[model samples]
Target: MTSPAPRDRVDELTVGSGARLEELVDRESLGQLATSFADLSGVGIRVFDAEGKLLADAAQPVELISYLSTLKHSRSAIESTVSSVKNLDPGPEGQAGIDGVSGGRYRVVALEHDGRRVGRLVIGPYFPPSLRDIPSQLLELEPALDLDRARQLLTMAPRVTDDSMDRLARHARAALDVVMFSGLRALLTGSMHLAAVRESYRELQSKQDKLQVAYDRLKELDRLKSNFLATVSHELRTPLTSIIGYSEMLLEGIAGEITGEQREFVTTIREKGEQLLTLIKGLLDLSKLESGTMSLRKATMEVAPLVRDVAQTMAPHAKKKGISLQAEVEAGLPALWADAERLRQVLLNLVENAIKFTSAAGSVKISARLSSLSTGGSADEGGLVLLGAQRTAVELRVADTGIGIPESERQRVFDAFYQVDSSSTREQGGTGLGLSIVKRLVEGHDGTVHVEANEPQGTAFVVAIPLKRATLRP
Candidate 1:
């Protein structure tokens, strides 16, 4: 696992009298500075914090120390020199102190931040270039000390002047400051990025909560609308049925002999009553379908006769509109498993709409065929089978050459009371519930219906009903 970040030390390094050098500069940068300076000036370097804790070091060669450790007196003196440098106090005017040891001298420079002492840098244990012979301290440390060998080892140590060592220490501190500044910049940038991301997440969550509340409100309103439609249609249907029955009686002369003009007026009243009754029935059917209470009497029946019957029933209406109505069924088409009455109602609605919308001299055609439909499913299965499978369905298309529905309005036309032309002076006369009821009835039979653009002109209503109940295939 990665190591945790260093303890927080901003206050210790930034503003207090007890500011620490190790807090101001990181350990990695300090070690690099010490190594670079020792290499450049040929001097041993070590770093310590205000608390006298050793942080980094690039000590001089081990050959001298290894040789001296063989004698107790020389080893003790060498360790004392290191301890003195580490424990040294900050000198006046940021100047370095040079102290002589048994073999050489150590230069201790105090480190400061904001005019306060924080740490120290020790660059020393280097020999003076003017040295002519082995030191007296090493010669007396052991009886086994070889004078010739000691002299040779002393030549191997780096020899530098006081001025050069002081310059090297300053360069090391300047380089470390740059590294510390870069590290602080990276930490601040990361904190800002984290805060921005959190804010965006909170805003997104707030929008989602609002959307959920709106969706729940729409659901409750829809339920209320369904109940209202069911109640109003039921109440209006009884009186409308009575009005239509009484008007039929007066027209047949059962109550009295009506005059010529009275007959025309009575006929208009019955016709208008019938129209109102049709609208009320549409509302009732729609409410039942929405509440999942509509019942269908399903059966397996031939498709050809049903198409021919719808065409025959609507043939007079098509003639009145001067539109040509035709029906075609593919030879040997399969029978459909569905509610015959409901299917007949679906055809009647499509054929009636096609005839009503087409202008004079226009054409409306009804066609059906037995076709294979590809339902969504995978081809291969290891143990579990995929969901949809290939099946045979009775496909029907009722197409017309009329003022075509615009692409944008085609889907909306299926919604109840949603009209392409809703203005008061609109030419077409429709309550707009016909197609909505037709859609619900078709889906109730496990069938699909959709409208598409007809070539050259007008719109086409396409429907597919499965020939048999859909099932998994091997």
Candidate 2:
């Protein structure tokens, strides 16, 4: 005949030495099981864990054992039997027995689960049918014993055959196996869950460490790039200034008489040189802004005058391009706390960009008015206006009828070196650093700048500066 299939088993290593009998099954449930079996079988029962801690006990008072306890020598003999029973090892067959002092016997049965012994059951102090009377050993220890009374007490003990007691012990062990199996399943489930959570946390922590390292590396690279730009821009400025000054002198015939073509060539050289100088200056300013080294000499200044000055300064360039330039300043506008020169540079850059993109017939308008600035929401939504109270600010709008910027590209316009028109053949000429510089300059004064579509056509660049002076970062 074919052998029965081997039972499925759990890995002993996974449970480890930490698995305990008491943890697998509760004492209250074990006590109830012991009580029920003891009541029905007329046998005393006790349960203990692997560590020898008594978990449950259910035994009816035996008159014989109680009477023997009154005699000093008999009580000593009884205590010795109880101690031996507690330390008894139920060997490979899983059961053992010992004789008590009162002619009763005790059975020790091993409790096992997953091929490992977790606890033991003690079924004890029950008389066997073969023992018809008290043993001579009990009388030898207690010579003053009343024979009649001792005999009466001996009859009170439960009597059963050896085969019957073995069967009862087997049945009780089987019932306990069910409880232990259920408890083991629960214990294993909890252990596995805890292991899984710990593993996930370890993986997450590893990824976070890698991300932090990458972030720190990027910051260092950015610092090095800023330093390079500052050094190169400073070195190029002195030579560039000489080139511009010489070209201007040559165009005015300072280098002796020159032909008409030579004059035009000299003029072109001067103009291009000036443009290069402007780009280098922009790069220097950007480096300073990024490194937080630029200083602002802030003072209370009127917005109306600043707006009119920007329009006046750009009028000649706009007229040359046949574009109408105008400034609309509201009367009695609040004074602004800002650096006059930096603010002028911001206005000039915006107006220049407007004229560069607008057609000959288009108009450019610079307007200044008193407005309420709200510091409440995210920068992308609009001004910061969602979470803070309204504060009085000077709002300057540089609107122009130029080729309008697309909605998708508006937010990116303030990024350094980014251009809406990046093709080689694009009409406008710029280093694309103007708006970036403008943004930093305005922010230095605790202000905000943003772009929107001009009504009907073109684009509007808005700058809002709060009236109050804030401590500026270097």
Candidate 3:
């Protein structure tokens, strides 16, 4: 049978340590339990894992400590990548992956009971009262890491003379006895998390299999839709062409005299037919894009002209709404590797949205700038984020003075058939699929889109895409 748990450090660390019976717990419990031991013996207690990982260091300050949070987050990722890499061998010894060292400082001791290694405990680099500041000799830490909080925390560590080193060790052993009880609780929590992840993974795998089945069915349905559209469009064009010819003949008096109402109705029918054809063509284009059947005619075309063209085409629409449109495409802007027609469509859509949303006297602006594309490979030096490599990024922004979307709903707006207002029969007339299609098309070119609130009022859509070619300065 295990020995009984001790009430005080003097009773605990002696030969009676074997009887300690509290369950091992984690940071929270360890923090509370440390206070109990601290209150009893007046020694500032700290605990770290076997690898010197700080399990509970109530002595530290959060604001003054930098990179610790990042290190903590990276811990899980490091563990995952390490585990994956270590599975190369089938031997039992190959399973040892987790690192045993905490990166910089602190000392650790194995917490054991009944000859079983439970966890670990750590004491710190806190200065003895004799010293004024943290010693630069121990760990190569930055001076800023040594703050007033560190000074305060260090003062609390139990002070002793060299002769009583063994007693200090015994006291540490007693402190660990209290900590082991809490560590057991932490171990149970970790086990529960592992089980939850396994269950979630199993569920995800099942859902993925269902998605595969659904996707196969969708492919068949898409094929049928394509065939139906092709047949109907061909039949439709033949009748439409004949109707146009007959209407022209009637207008030229080839047929007998008709009433004014009859002529007006015929004219309306002809106009509606033409609109229907346009809608049908849009459908065909959208389908081809979705099916990966649309062929791109790639060319190195100057961007300035395209920007001007889009602005010009949409200028009439803007004029009708009394909105001022601005185009700030730079002179001698480098040629972009793009399909001219499709790029035109992309710009046109953005310009149309800008015009549609803006009120009279409000302005819509189109601007472009060249920048480094990679957000990841940048370093922060002197409080500025600068890119390591000179890769090309073209920034295209459509800023409008109109109603802007809220931050919470920005991403949801990109979803197909999603709109800001979903009230029954609202004023806005749209399929709510334009932005969705726009997002997909841009992503295909390895680009990103984000919406920002336009100053005062309105939304600014930022599009960042990597340039096909770049010229680095010597």
Per-prediction TM-score, please?
Answer: 0.67, 0.80, 0.49
lDDT of all predictions, in order shown? 0.77, 0.87, 0.59
Clash number for each model: 0, 9, 14
lDDT tens per residue, model 2, 235-304: 9999999999999888778889899998889899899999899999999999999999999999988777
Off by over 4 Å in 1: 1-165, 183-199, 245-269, 290-302, 337-339, 370-393, 440-448, 465-474
Residues 1-474, candidate 1: write the lDDT tens digits: 222233222212322223356655678878887887777777878887766778898886746667877777777777777677666665685655655434677777776665656667777787777776777656666656777887788888777666666676677666655764555555445444555676688889999899999999998898789989999999999999999999999999999999999999989999999999888888999999888889987877888999999999999999999999999999988667788888888899888888877899999999998765545643345333346765677889999999889999988989999878889998767788888988988888666788899999998999888666543222
Kindly list the per-residue Cα lDDT of model 3 for residues 94-144, writing each as its tens digit. 111122111212233455665654444443222234555444431233333
- Quote the positional error of residue 121 for candidate 3 in Å: 39
Order of quality (TM-score) = 2, 1, 3
Name the candidate that leads on lDDT.
Answer: 2
Over the full model, what C-alpha lDDT does candidate 1 score relative to the true structure?
0.77
Where's the lowest-lDDT run of ten residues in candidate 3? 93-102
